[model samples]
Target: MTEFLDALVAHAFLQKALIAGLLASIGCGLIGPFVVVKRIAFMAGGIAHAVLGGMGAALYFGFDPLAGALVAALVSAILMGMVHLVWQAQEDTLISALWAVGMAIGILFIAKTPGYQADLMSLLFGNILLVPDRALVWMIALDLVLALTIAACYRPFLALAFDAEFARLRGLPVTVFYLLLLCLVALTVVLLIQVVGLILVIALLTLPAATAGHYVRSLGTMILIATLLGAFFTTLGLALSFGPDLPAGPTMILLAAAAYILSASLSHGLKQRRARLQIRDG
Candidate 1:
C-alpha cells in the first residue's frame, strides 16, 4: 500500500487527481446535506446533462470546453429554477426535455466538427490520469466559494430543504433561496464535469449523502460522514482504476454504490439483531 501511494505521488497526474478529489470532497460534503434533504437529485442530473450544449458551443467557437460547459450548466440551472415560477405542469417534465435537448445539441456539434478526435472516453466518463496542478488550483477555489456559501446560507437552505412552508412563513425569501441552491448545484455540476464528467456526476452528488444519512443521527454528523465517504470512494476508485483499466468516473460511482450497499447491509443486520433481542427479552 505504501509503495502504491509512493508511486501515485511520484506521478504528477495522480498526485493532482488525489488532491482535487480531496478539495471536491470538502465542498460536496458541506453542500450535500441540503441537496439530499431538498430532493434535488433529478434537478442536479438535469443540469449535468444540460451542460452538453455549452460544451458544444465552446468547442465550435474555439474556446475551452470547461468555459462552455460552465455557461451551459448555469443557464440550464436558471431555466430549471424558472420552471417553478412559470406555473408549469411539472418541473420534472421540463427538466427532462431540457436535458434531452442539451444532449442532442452536443451530438450535433460533435458530428459537424471536422477531424474531431477527442478522447470521448475521458470526457464521457473521467480521466483522473489527466488531472493537473492547474485543475487542482481551480478545485481549491471552488471549494472555498462553496465553504463561504454554505456558511452564509446554512439557515436559509436548511429551512428551505426540510420545510419550505415554514421558511416562507418566516419571510425567508424561499424563491430566491431555492434558485440559489439550484444555481450552486449547477456550478458544482460544472466543476464535477472535469472530475467525473456528466455521466456519473449525479452519483457523486447523491450517493455519499444518501449513504451517510443511514447511520448518522444529526444533519451535521451526516455531512461529515458523507464527506469522508466521498473522499474515500474517490481514492478507492483511483486505486481500482489503476487495474481494471476502467475509467475513473464509473469506477468512483461503483465504489460509492458499494459503500451504500455495505451501509444498508449493516443497517439491516442491526435491525434484525435488535428484533431478536426484543423477542428474547419478551
Candidate 2:
C-alpha cells in the first residue's frame, strides 16, 4: 500500500489512470441503475461488443478508434431499441446476432490490418495505465453530457424504467424516451471501455449499481451509492494491481464481482431472517 501510494505520487500515468476511472464511474453510476431496473444488460452488452467493429474499422481506415466506437455504439443502441419496440418476441435473438456479428467483424478487420496491432489486446481487455491526456479530456466531455442529459430527463427516464405503459398513458413519449435511454447507454458503454475494455465492461457497468440496488429502494439513492462503490472498486483495484503487477482491468472487475456477491448474500440472509421472525411472531 505504501509503495503504491509513493509510486502514485511519482507517476503521471497513474494519476491519469485514477482520474479516468473516477470519470468512468460517473457514467456507470448514472446509467447502471436504469440498466438494472429495466433488465437491459443484454442490450447494453450487445452495444458494447459492437463497438469493437467500429474501432477495428477505424484503425483500418486511419481514423480515431474512439470515434468509430461512438458511431457503432449509437447505431447499435438505436437498432436494438427499434427491435425491442416492434419485435419484442424476437428481441433477444436479434440482439444476440448483433453481438456475434459485431465481434466477428472486428476480429476480421483487426486480422487484416497490417503491422503488429499492439493496442488490440489492450482494447479487448484494457490497460488503464495507457490512458492518455487526450482521452481524459474526452472522458470529461462525455461525463458532462451524460450528467446534463440525465438531469433534464430524470423524471421521464424514471417513468420509462418502471411502467412504460403507464408512462405512455401519462402522455409521455415513451418510444422517444426509450430510444434516448438506449443512446445514453451506448455513450456510457464507450466511456467505460477505457477503464475496463470491451469484454469486461458489462461487469463494471452493472455490478456496482446492482450492489447498490440491494440496499436502496430509491433510484436516486441507488445511483449515489453505486457511483461511490464504483469509485472505490476502481481506485482500490488499481492500487492493488500496482503492487502485484496484475492486470488492472480484470483486477477491478474481480473486485466488483466479489462485492456484488457479498452484498447479494447479505441481503438474502437478512430477508430470510426477517421472514423467520415474522413467522415466529405470528
Candidate 3:
C-alpha cells in the first residue's frame, strides 16, 4: 500500500486512473439504485454489451471508439425502452437477442479489422492504468451530465422505480421518464467501461449498490453508501493490485463480490434473528 501510494504520487497516469474510478463511482452510485429497484440489471447488461459493437465498428472504420460506444449505448437504450413499453410480453426475448447480437457483431468487426488490436483485451476486461487524459476528460463530462440529470429527475425517477403504473396515473410522463432512465443507465455503463471494461462493467455497476441495499431501505441513502463503497473498492483494488502485479479490473471486481457476499450473509442473519425474537415475544 505504501509503495502504491508512493508510485501514485509520482505517476500522472495513476492519478488519472484514480480520478476515472471516482467518476465512475459517482455514475454507478447515482444510477445503480434505480437499476436495482426497477430490476433492470439485465437491460443494462444488454446496453453494456451492445457498446462493444459500436467500439468495434469505430475501430474498424477509424473513428473514436468511445464516441462510437456512446452512440451505440444511447441507441440501444432507446430501442430497449420502446420495446419494454410497447412489447412488454416480448421484452426479455428481444433484450436477450439484442445482447447476443450486439456481442456477435462486435466480435465479427474485431476479427475483420486488420492489425494486432493491442487494446482489444483492455476493452474487454479493462486496464485502468492505461486510461488516457482524453478519457478522463470525457469521464468528467459524462459525470456532470449524469449528476445533473439525476438531480433534475430524482422525484419522477423515484416514482418510476417504485411504481411506474401509479406514476403514469398521476400524469408523470412515465414513458419519457422510463426512456430517460434507461439512457442514464446507458451513459453509466459507458462511463464505467474504462474502469472495468465491458464484460465486468455490470458487476462494478450493481455490486456496490446491491451491498448498500442490505443496509439501507432509503434509495437516497443507498446511493450515498454505494458511492462511498465504490470509491473505497476501486482505490483499494488499484493499490492492492499494483503491489501484486495483478489485473486491476478483475481485482476490483473480486473485492466487490467478497464485500457483497459478506453484506448479504450478515443481512440474512440479522433478519432471522429479528424474526426469532419476534416469535418469542409473541
Candidate 4:
C-alpha cells in the first residue's frame, strides 16, 4: 500500500487525478440523491450528451470547452424546465428533441473543425490523467458550492421530492425548487464531464447512489456511503489504468457497476431469507 501510494504521488498527473476525483465525488455524492429520488437518470443522460455540443462548439470557436458546457447546460436546463411548465404534455419528446439537437450540433461543430478528430476524444471519454491544474481548481470550488447548497436546501428538497403536492399545498415553492434542482444537476453534469466524460458520467453519478440505497435509509447516510464508494472506484480505477493502460473513466464506471450488481444480488438474497424465516415462524 505504501509503495502504491508512493508511486501514485510520484507523478504530477496522478496527483491532479486524485484531487479531481475527490472533488468530483463530493458533488456527485451531494446531488446524486436528487437524481435517484426524482428519477432523472435519463434526463441526466440527455444533459450529459447535450454538453458535447457545447464543448464541440467551444473547441471550434477557440474558447474554453468548460465555458461552452456551463452555458449549454444552464440554457438547456432552463429550456427543458420550461417545456414541462408550458405543455406538461410531451416532456419526453421535448427533452429528447433537445438532446438530439445538441448532439447534432456537437457533431457538426466537430466535423467543421479542421485536423482534429482524435484530439477531443479525451474530453469525450474523460482523460483524468490529463486534467490540468486550472481545471482542478474549478472542480474544487464547484464541489464545495454543491455540497453547501445541498446541505442548506436538503429538507425542502426532500419535501419536494417525496410529496411535491403537499409541499405546494404548504405554499413551498415547488417551481423554484424544481428549477434549482435542474440547475444544480446541470452544474454537476459539467463537473462530472471532467471526471468521467459524458459517456460514463451518468454511470458514476447514479450507480453509487443506488448501491448505497440498498443499505442506507436516510439520505445523509446514502450520500456519505456513495461518496466513499465513488472515491474507492476512482482510486481503484486509477490503479487499474496504471496497469492495463485502459481509460480511467470507463474502468471506474465498470467498477461501480460491479458494486451495483453485487449489492442488488445481496439485497435479493437477504430478502428471500427473511421471507423464508417469516414463513417458518408462522
Question: In terms of TM-score, which candidate is strongest?
Answer: 2
- Candidate 1 lDDT (Cα, whole model)? 0.80
Output the lDDT of residue 264, model 3.
Answer: 98
- Candidate 2 C-alpha RMSD relative to the actual structure: 0.9
Quote each prediction's TM-score: 0.92, 0.98, 0.97, 0.95
Clashing pairs in 3: none
- In candidate 3, stretches whose alpha carbon ends up further than 4 angstroms from where it belongs are none
Worst 10 residues of 2 by lDDT: 111-120
Candidate 1, 1-282: lDDT as tens digits: 565487686877778787777776776687676678788888888888988888777777788777788788888988988986684678778889999999889877766766553755566666767876666776777777777887888778888888899989999999999888887888777667677878888888888998998887777787798889889988888777775566777888998988888988998899899999999998
lDDT per model vs. reference: 0.80, 0.93, 0.91, 0.85
**Could you tell me the lDDT of residue 166 within candidate 1?**
92
Worst 10 residues of 3 by lDDT: 111-120
| Decoy 4 TM-score against native | 0.95
Q: Which 10 consecutive residues of model 4 have the lowest summed lDDT? A: 1-10
Q: Model 1, clash count? A: 0
Question: Candidate 1's error at 210, in angstroms?
Answer: 0.6
Candidate achieving higher TM-score, 2 or 3: 2
Choose 1 or 3, whichever is better by lDDT: 3
lDDT of candidate 3 over 61-172, digit per residue (tens): 9898899899989999999998898999999999989988888888888888998277789989999999888888899999999999989988999999998899999999
* Candidate 2 lDDT tens digits, 1-282: 999899999999999999999999999999999999999999999999999999999888888888999999999999999999999999999999998888888888888889727888898888899998888888998899999999999999999998999999999999999999999999999999998999999998899999999999899998999999999999999999999999999999999999999999999999999999999998
Error of 3 at 43 (Å): 0.6
